[model samples]
Target: MTDTGQPSTAIARAQDSTALACQRMGDGYPLVLLAGQANNHHWWDRVRADFHATHSTITFDMRGTGGSGKPQGPYSTKQFADDVVAVLDHLSIERADVYGTSMGGRVAQWVAARHPARVRRLVLGCTSPGGPHAVERDASVRRALAQADPEAARRALTDLMYTPAWLADHPGPYTTLGDPDMPAHARHGHLVASNGHDAWDALQGITAPTLLLHGDQDRLTPPDNLPLLAARIPRTTSHVFPGARHAYFEECRAEASALVSAFLDEGP
Candidate 1:
């Protein structure tokens, strides 16, 4: 562990030759934490320690972000799922519990669907099950995201991700905003992959007991997607953090982490 007690990092190579940066720490049942689009392993920094006593937590940087390779794209969430499997394979971890947020949650759907045996349990937070059936964010939110200036776009997203009161109290170097220096092509790839995700059919194939979590006030992914997921996945439980926004896991870390721990501890 690092001085802050966070895990030590390592690298894993994907089939496509993408170098994935990953971290492993703690002990017991392995647990993988997946970050949203553009964000990296650091996205879970605040809450990772919460799971150390109960799980051997794993985290990694997705392609195009953090220490991972930023290859050209037309990237797909399916490909991202494959990359995740590659990381696990590298570590010789055949199966693990997965917790993902935003785009990472979308990727987790594919992981559980396509490689059912590799996931023992799944947690999806502030995410969507895209395609025609999925409820979308308002047009105004989309418009704000389309801002020409990157800083302005980040600002707009920050507002939507956290409640005003939370921001007032917590000073940031917010890891959730993702890599500012990511190449333009890679950033576009993440957007295309995330926006194009469609998991309605895949959700049914997941063999793991799934947990759907969201913030009631979330505008980015919207709380409506939670029930949609719960209805589709074979075994599911859901919770919506009252008055919270997209980053509810962080905003309500103690409660959220405890809830997650309880669920993962359940017997098959």
Candidate 2:
């Protein structure tokens, strides 16, 4: 899913934080992008322009994703966070403005909670603080995810993940945005890790400034968790995209990037 239009890049081996494969470009302060499960660093495709002009943007393949190596079983959110730290260490970045989408947000939550010193600021988009307090997946979405046919599953899952109008408007990404090479075990590992995440208590202890972004029409990871996140996390603000869905960052790239850029620029 790496964008062909992206800048020249190289992979780094992060030994300290679980040793995943990472790629970075851009200039200025380090702004690391953590993508969701089932995808790799390439998922950041359409939004790179928003940050690259102003910041040293970074993106990586979490273990079990992209060019990274995957070990056997028992992956957890905190482990994912550690992998993030490894990337920063490998790149010689002391701290970074960390942005996490969907399952990556869970990893970011752990970084902010457990390794607060590593994160300068935090952005959690289209994600949840999984626990008893978190919103449950819709039955339709669950069924779609379980579909046996790969293409059917992709279509069905995207149907839940995107707004109807958004899918119609951005057919390119909707149809072509996928990592065909990601292995089945790796995908399952991420899914298992994502489902196991529970940062309910960890949210309150995050030391960095934080932002939560979500689409009002999102069905997969609904807006229902926003209130809970606001109440738990201190020094946090949020933005809602009217009529947007899970992939609002792409569907409304201009507006979303503007908001994110403004926020990133303001932080020290």
Worst 10-residue lDDT window for candidate 1 reads: 1-10
lDDT of 1 by residue, 1-268 (tens): 3234767788899987889999998887889999999888888988988888778898988999888999997799999999999999999999999999999999999999999999999999999999988999999999998899978998999998899899999979799987777898998999999999998988898989999999999999989999899999999999999999999999988899999999999944
Model 2 Cα lDDT, one tens digit per residue, 1-268: 2334555455556443344777777777888888888688888877875887778778888888778887666678888888888778778888899999888888999989998888888989998999899997798888887889978988876776677787677676542245678777877888899999999988999988898899988888888887788889998889999988788788878988888888888887
- TM-score of candidate 2 on Cα atoms, chains taken together: 0.92
- Pairs of residues clashing in candidate 2: 17-82, 17-83, 17-86, 27-56
Q: Candidate 2: which stretches are off by over 4 Å?
A: 1-19, 174-178
Error of 2 at 145 (Å): 1.6
Worst 10 residues of 2 by lDDT: 1-10
Best by lDDT: 1
